[model samples]
Target: MKRQRNRGRVTLASIAAMCAVAALPGQAHAADDPAPYAFDPEAATVRGTETNAEASELKSGSVYRSAIKPGQKLYYRLNLDDDTNAYVSAVAVPPSGGKVAYGDGITVSIRDVDDTQCGSEDAIFGSGEFARPIAAYAHRVIEKGNSTCREAGEYNVLIERKSNATSSPDEWDLELRYASEPAVKAADAQETEAPENWSSASPVPPSGGQKRSGGSSFYEATGLETGEWHDTIVPGQTRFYRVPVDWGQQIFATAALSNNPKSTEYLGNALSLSLDNPVQGHVDDTTLSYSGEPASVALDPLPPVDYRNRFASASDVSAMRFAGWYYLSVTLSPEVAKSYGDEAIQLRLKVNVRNDPKASPYEGAAGIFGVSDEDKDMAKSGQSAPQAAQSDTMKLVAAAGIGAGAVLVLGLGAWTLLARRRTAPAAVPAAAGGQQPPYGGPTRTW
Candidate 1:
C-alpha cells in the first residue's frame, strides 16, 4: 500500500497549530502508513510593508507574507544593540509559469535611520532559475566603533522589485525572517573557534529520495531514510526533506554541494546547509561561498534527545536535540545564477541515524508537550518506572497534529507546464521558534 502523508497545503493558522503540535510529546504508531506531512512555518500571511514601518512597529523572527506591485517597495525597521547580530532573509515565491526574462529583479539594502547604506544586494531571479523560489538574505553585526550603522538603534531593511515583466498583478508572497544573533564575548571568542570533532555512523540508512527535477518546491520534501541520498537542485533555491528519528536515535548528516562543471562562470560559494529540529527552530546552519567550486556541510550526531529541557547548541543543530522528524534544509545562493541556465546542480547526502545510550529514546510512552510524561515522572522520583502504552494521539501529535489530505489541483490554463505534480512535493512544517532550541517559541522582537 502507498504510504499516506500530509498533503502539506498550509496557512499561518495551520502552521501555528503545527507549532503547537510540535511542542507535544511523541506517541507510538501501530505499524500504520506514514502520516500526512506537517504545516509550513514560513507561509504566514503578512501585513502591509509597502511603506517602511517604524522599528517599534515591525515584527522580527516571524515570516511575514505580503506582496507588492511592480516598481513598488517594502521597508522594515530594525532596532539593534552593539552586541546583537542582525539577520534578514527575504523569500520571493514566484508565480507558476511566469515568463520571467531578465528575472524578477530584487534589490535589498540595509541603512541606518540616517540613510547610511550598511549593506545591499541585488538578487535577480534569472531565467535560469525557473523551477523553484528564490531568496535574498543580508546580515550585519554591530561592533565597537563601527563607522556605518554604528550603535544601531534603528535600521531599515528595504526591498524593491527592479522589474515588472514576469510577476502577476496579484502580490507575490514576500516572506522575511529577521533575527538577532548574540555576539561572542572576548573571553569565549577563542573557544568558539575550536573545530568540531566530526564523527560518522557505520552502515548509513539505506534509503534515498528520487532524483530532483527542475520544479521541486519546499513543500513536497522527498522522504529520506538513513543512508546516502543523492539529488540535484537549482541555484537560488532552497530544498526541504524529512527524516523521522525516534527518541533514542542520534542523527548525522553531511552534504556535498558542488558547482556545475559545464559552466565557465565564477560561482560564488553561496551554499547554505542546515538542520531544523522538531520543536526548536534552526539548530545549525553554515554558509560557504562557492565561487564556482564545491563546499560541504558535515553535521554531527546530536546529543541524545530527551523531550524535556533540551541542551542548547547552535540555532540550526540544537533543535535536533529531540526525537522526531528533523528537517534537512539546503539553500543555494545565486552566485551560480548566471552560470547555470536552467540546469540542475548536483547534491549528495550522507545521512546516519543510530541508537544512543546517553540520549532518551522516543521508544518510551510520550508525555506532555512532547515530553514523555513518564520521563518527567521519573525525573521527579529519581528513578525509572514503567509507563502506559502510547496512544494514537501520540502519533498525531508527533506528525504535527495534522488532519488528512485532499486533492490539490492546479489551474489548467496557461501554466500547465509549471503546475506539474511531478514537480516538488509540498513542504514539511516547523515552527521556526524565534531563534533556536532551549527556547520554546519563535524569537520575534515584538
Candidate 2:
C-alpha cells in the first residue's frame, strides 16, 4: 500500500509538470509571431467601396483605417473647397513572412467628380522585395492657372494594390490620412522658387547619443529632434522615427550599424535607410552591404522646405515642399540572421537640422506645417501620441495573465492534495510525541 501511494503521487506530479510545460510553448509561439502595424486607436474604421457613388467620405485632418486585397481598386470620397490644397496619403502594410515581388506595390490618386485625375503617385517594393510598409501620396494642389483639379467640390481618392499571382494572398492593411492646407494670403503668395544654390555635401552625423527606441509604424514612430540617437535592431526588423522640420529648414540624417563579432560573413544589401516626407512621399533611400563590420549610409542632400518647391522638376526637391514630421526608417535584412546569430545589432543615427524656421503664409489651418513647443516636449520624452493607450493595453493583458496563473496554481495544488488523500489510508496516529512519521507521512508540504 505504501508503494502504491508513492507511485500515484509521482504520477500526479508528472501529469502536473506536463501540463505546465504544454502551456509554455503556446506563449512562446505567440511572442515569436510578427508584430502587426500599430494603427491609431482613435482612427475611424472605414470600408472602401468599389464605386465613387458608394465611396465613404474622408474628413480632413483625420486618420482612417481600411484594407485592400490583390487587384482591388477602392474609392473614398472627399469634400473640399476651391481654396484649400488637399493632400491624401495611403500606407499599405503587407503581412510579415508573406512573399512579395519587386513589382508589388500600391498606387494612389485624386480625381474630380468628372473623372479628371488631379494627381497620382505609386510606390513599389523595389529591389528589397521584402514584406514591409509602403507609402504613396496624391494631392490636389490649388495651383494658380492650373485648370484641371482646382475646383474640388466633390473629389474621390482612388487606391489600388498591384500584385502578381505568385504574391501572398493575404490582404494588406491600409492607413490613410487627409490634410487640407489653406491657400496663402494674397500678399504672401509670391512664387517662392526652389533654392538656387545649396551645399550638396553631406553633414557629419553626431556621435555619442542618448538611447531611444524606435516605433514599429508611422503612427507609433518615436519623435526625434536634431541630434544623435542610438537604438538596437534585430534581423528582419524595421524601426521608424520622425523628426520635425519646419519651413526653410533642412534635415540631414545618417544611419550606422555596429560590427558583429559573432560573424564576418558578407551579405549584400543587408541594411537600408529611407526617408519619407510629411505626406508619406518617398524622398530618398540608401542601402549598405555588411560583412559584420560597421557600415553607414547617408541620405543625399535635400533642399529646404518651401511651399513653392512643388514646381521643382526633381522629385527629391518637390518632396521637400512641405514641413512637418519627416519619417526615417531603418531596416536590417532578414538574411543577416543566418550569419549574425539573430542577435540585435547596435544602431546609431546622426541627425542635423539646419536653417531657422520661416513664418508660414497660410490664412487657415497651417499648424500641421510647423513644429510646436509641445512637439519638442514630446520628442524629448521619446513618446508618440498613441503610446499611452498602448501601455494601458499591455498592463491589462499582464494583469489578466497573473490572475489566470494564480487560479491555475491553486487548482493544481488542490487536485494533488485531494488525490493523495483518496489514495492513502486513513492518517496514522502521530508517533509518541505527536510527530509525523518519516515515511508515508500525512503532513502536507505543498
Segments of candidate 2 deviating more than 4 angstroms: 1-34, 387-446
- Every candidate's lDDT: 0.50, 0.80
Residue 413 local lDDT, model 1 = 31
Error of 2 at 207 (Å): 1.5
Please give, for residues 242-320, the per-residue lDDT of candidate 1 as tens digits. 5556655666777776655665565444566656554223455445555446666676455444432222334323344
- Among these predictions, the greatest TM-score belongs to 2
For all predictions, the C-alpha RMSD in Å is 22.9, 11.5
Kindly list the per-residue Cα lDDT of model 2 for residues 1-446, writing each as its tens digit.
Answer: 65456556655655655454443311211212334667766679999999899999999999999999999999999998877788999989888768888799999999999999998888887777667787889989876667888774899999999998999989999999998776787865667455677766666666669987887788778888878998888777778898988888889999999999988898877888889988788888878789989998788889888877888878778888877889998877788888987777889988998889988767765667767777777777776656534444456555655655665676677778877876554456555787656765465534
Cα-lDDT of candidate 1:
0.50
What is the RMSD of candidate 1? 22.9
